[model samples]
Target: MYGGVAAVKELSLIVCRGEFLTILGPSGSGKTTALMLLAGFISPTNGDILVGGKSVASVPSYRRDQGIVFQSYALFPHLSVRRNLEFPLEMRGVKAAERADRVANLLARVHLDNFGDRMPSQLSGGQQQRVALARALIADPPVLLLDEPLGALDRNLREQMQSEIKTLHKEFGITTVCVTHDQEEALTLSDRIIVMRGGAIEQIDTPEGLYDRPKSLFVANFLGEANLLNGVIPLPNDATPTSMLSIIRPERIRLAVPHAPTLADAHQRQQANGVVTEVIYAGALRKYNVQVGNNVLIMREHVASDQQVFRPGDQVRLDWLRSDVRLVATETNNGVE
Candidate 1:
């Protein structure tokens, strides 16, 4: 127990060999604490932490042999880039010449070949992150722990580093555990994501499964833009429906010119009438806020230069395949997760 409060409960999942597992949750969700427990920085109150099928519950952080990269770069400000990378090898008693070779190879691998002589203060945020990653991998540990590794970087650099981290994981084939509050980052980088709330496992699935088939309202709303229409809605091929809140993705919604000719191929499925309330121009997609009765729904369409753009005050019809509608927990859902 953490301060007599359960910081994590019913948390169970295996980080497969060479798989990237991300623990995703909002603040105070115990994601960071879980990572620390896995890394031997903190011990679980009652539970076995197995590494390679052996319990390491009493092992200290330094003895775990797990590479860790903190949110802060954690590089020694007084050291040059090369020295920071060499420190791990030195601690392991590697000879100077061998450490030099490994450091050089890692520098080249992280695209920091020319910045080896510079200090951490001299490098850009992205560069420092790369150095931190290279250091984590320098010893070639079988398991890696990353605690909000990209939380410090800006948007553009965050994306760039994300690609780099994925490449590194693929090249090294290490079992990795990442803790992050960024949903997009988890979706983009994880092989399997574990969504945590109130220190418990809400759902654990691949990025696609979590987004397309979330069973809870909290997960449905947390992962992406979700429209929860109240009461019964169309279910699959059958017109007979069940009573529950209907969850539909914004992209699943299709908007068409009202009273226009219904195309024979598509857009003839389940339909509804609404007036455009707002149009948002997001670089690659146009998000339309539509009002149906007293409900306002969000519909996202791909932005095309040649397509007609619907504006506010325009009457539009929203259509979707019955298969796209997913029922939220009718009885099991009690408020949020």
Candidate 2:
């Protein structure tokens, strides 16, 4: 077993150059450990990690030329922002003149151009984070690794920093690997997400691909809120067959009118009926908990300026495109409840 328990089993992953990839999973799913292995903080017992098409399993962390930003900011309290930014360059013996230019440029890039004289304790959490980011980038490493670098900020600051980080990545075109437990953050920031479980890779795909076509039930439930109903394959449609575990996203489900035509017909494809048990108004959208026979289904609809509202105990119908229904492999102990 790896990490004293089967943390990762035969896991292999590849991150393309200049691609922003986020590893997402619940706590103890080995997302951080996987990143640590790639960063040379830990070694994989059974698999190899490659960076830039070269095996990095044997490369020491310091010589790997990868920039890392951690959750703690990890700035030196005694040093000014400028000195902190220059520390990495100093270690590399970069001349004083070039280091000054690089640090000045990085300070501007991270939006701390005038804060160079400030100590870490004198800055706000967000500003300190920006300094940490600038310090990491001062050396201009080929790869960047961020381990929940935005976890300490408030909701507003976190969102702002998310955009800032993305902008910085685009500006530098650096290959970045981010490890995050926040599903929404992963979905928003990553060009692609690698979902992990039990220290193993579950699925790696673009956010749209993973959300629209989950390969397993674990991924379906992890990526977003899924209204999964256990139902037998009644029969294969003459057109296409479905597997045992199939799921549909809440947003894809729609409210249907009883008199609508069957879903098989082209004009009536977006129609199905269910009984509404609960209605939740969540500002931007309304969520309805509907029951179709023994299955409890969830439907989400955007709150329109002029829309009829439904209440609990209302007889409602659910509808969605057939193409939106995704078939997935069975999941074990998904812990979604």
Candidate 3:
């Protein structure tokens, strides 16, 4: 909470041992504040934080022993990579010989073995980030906290660092909590993710769970591209359509070429007739935007070696498996289903 405004409210979460949990949200959503609370940099307004069954809500930041990597890398510009890696050890009163050994081991671990003599300014962005991670881990902390750690790098470097970070997590087997606004990053890095909105937990589940079975409209729209149909969806063999919201992923939707038999085969699946409004090509996949009954839905499909491609102004039918339609609560203030 800040300035008497509730940043996070009625929040309770569990991070499993040795699990990588990511807190994903946009700016001003309180993900970073929650991270600070867990790191002991700030105390919760009225809650307890437990690590291994011990409550540490009031513990000081220095005593938490959780290694944190910030978005800025936060390396000592004047210090060589070796000294930067050694600072934490020195703070813990580790002897010179042990510090040297630990530094060497971490240098090798982060694949910066011969770069220790160089200053942070001399290394590339990715190299310096690796050093930051190495320094965080050199102290042998049980938990790792990362706050948008890849937000500073270029796209290519970000992807590379993501792979490196995942490798490190697998190798170290440490419980990790990362905060980021990037949906792709959360899906790629986290074993499970906590999606935050309005300073509160909107949803908490595995990446697949959140994507495939989102409980709310906000979640459905946030996790990926979703085509939402308002009002009741018409169920086959039912007389009346149920009043609610329905979601279908772009990829789950399939496009069928217009044929005379389509009307006769309508009973087999949920089908809608639409005119193609746009086509997008992106190497491996193609996206089609279709306009149907005052609604525009996007259908994404992989481009097979010998697949037929549809263009704008083409008449086509969009269909999906009955089970692919997910029902959601229509009212925004209503509790999630």
Candidate 4:
């Protein structure tokens, strides 16, 4: 709690060994506070943290055996890459000869073999990031903590670093806990994701599970693009309960020419017709906003050579298998209803 306000409330989780778990949410969602609590940087007012079957809640950040990578790439600006890598080993009383060997191998592993003599200021943003990651793993800690690790990089660079982090995680087999607001990053790198909302856990599931079958309306909209189907279209009698909300992903809805002939599986599909209100052309995919009744439903389709493109004001038919529609819980009184 910070100044009598609970940043995380009734939070309980278990991170499996060698698992890559990511805490994902928007600003003020307590994701970072949760990471800090795990890192021993902050104390939990009413709970204990156990690492490897022992209590570590009272352990200081420096005393806990863990690796941390900060968003700023907190490298020592005055030291050369080699010296920076050696600092941790030196503090741990490792011999000079062994430190040199370990530093040499790690520099090569991060693909900075020839640049070890350069200072932190001399390297590019990506290079600095690599150095930070290498330093964190140098001690070979059992746990790795990442706080918004990729937020400082550009789009292309962020994607590249994502692959690098994934590869290193596989090779090291270290249990990792990462915090980020980027849904794509969480989905791409996590074995499982925890969606946090208002200082509590909204949902915890595999990336595919969270995206395909969110447990709440907030999760459905947070993980990816969702089309809320409540009062917008007629649903089957048993499809959704009064306490649940119906939603479908944009990509799950198929677009066809207006008045198109019904398909063989028509009995299993729900169809609707609407005018195309907007058309978005992303390089590899086309997105359409169709006005059906009083709601604007979004649909996405891959751009193909033979695919017909729709324009604004064009009449279009949308259809999806009834099974594709998901029923999620609704929020009430600032909690799931």
Candidate 2 lDDT over 1-337, as tens digits, reads 5536776665777788999999999998889888888789877676677877788898889888889999999999999999999999999999999999998998988888899999999999999999988988889898999999999999999999999999999999999999999988998899999998876778889999988888887888888878764452242353233434657899987675666455555553444457789999898989998877778888888999887677877787676666777667764333322
Q: After superposition, how far is residue 309 of candidate 1 from its true place, in Å?
A: 1.1
Residues 160-236 of candidate 1 have per-residue lDDT tens digits of 99999999999999999999999999999999998888888788899999999987777888799788665324354
TM-score of each: 0.94, 0.90, 0.92, 0.97
Residue 6 deviation, candidate 4, in Å? Answer: 0.1
Tens digit per residue, CA lDDT, model 3, 204-223 = 99999999998777888888
TM-score of candidate 3 relative to the true fold: 0.92
- State which candidate, 1 or 2, has the greater TM-score: 1
Residue range with the least summed lDDT across 10 consecutive positions in model 2: 232-241
- Candidate 2 lDDT (Cα, 0 to 1): 0.83
Total backbone collisions for each predicted model: 0, 4, 1, 0
Give candidate 4 regions above 4 Å deviation: 236-242, 332-337
Spell out the clash pairs found in candidate 4: none
Model 4 lDDT at residue 258: 86
Model 1, stretches more than 4 Å misplaced?
231-243, 265-268, 330-337
Residue 267 of model 1: what lDDT? Answer: 51
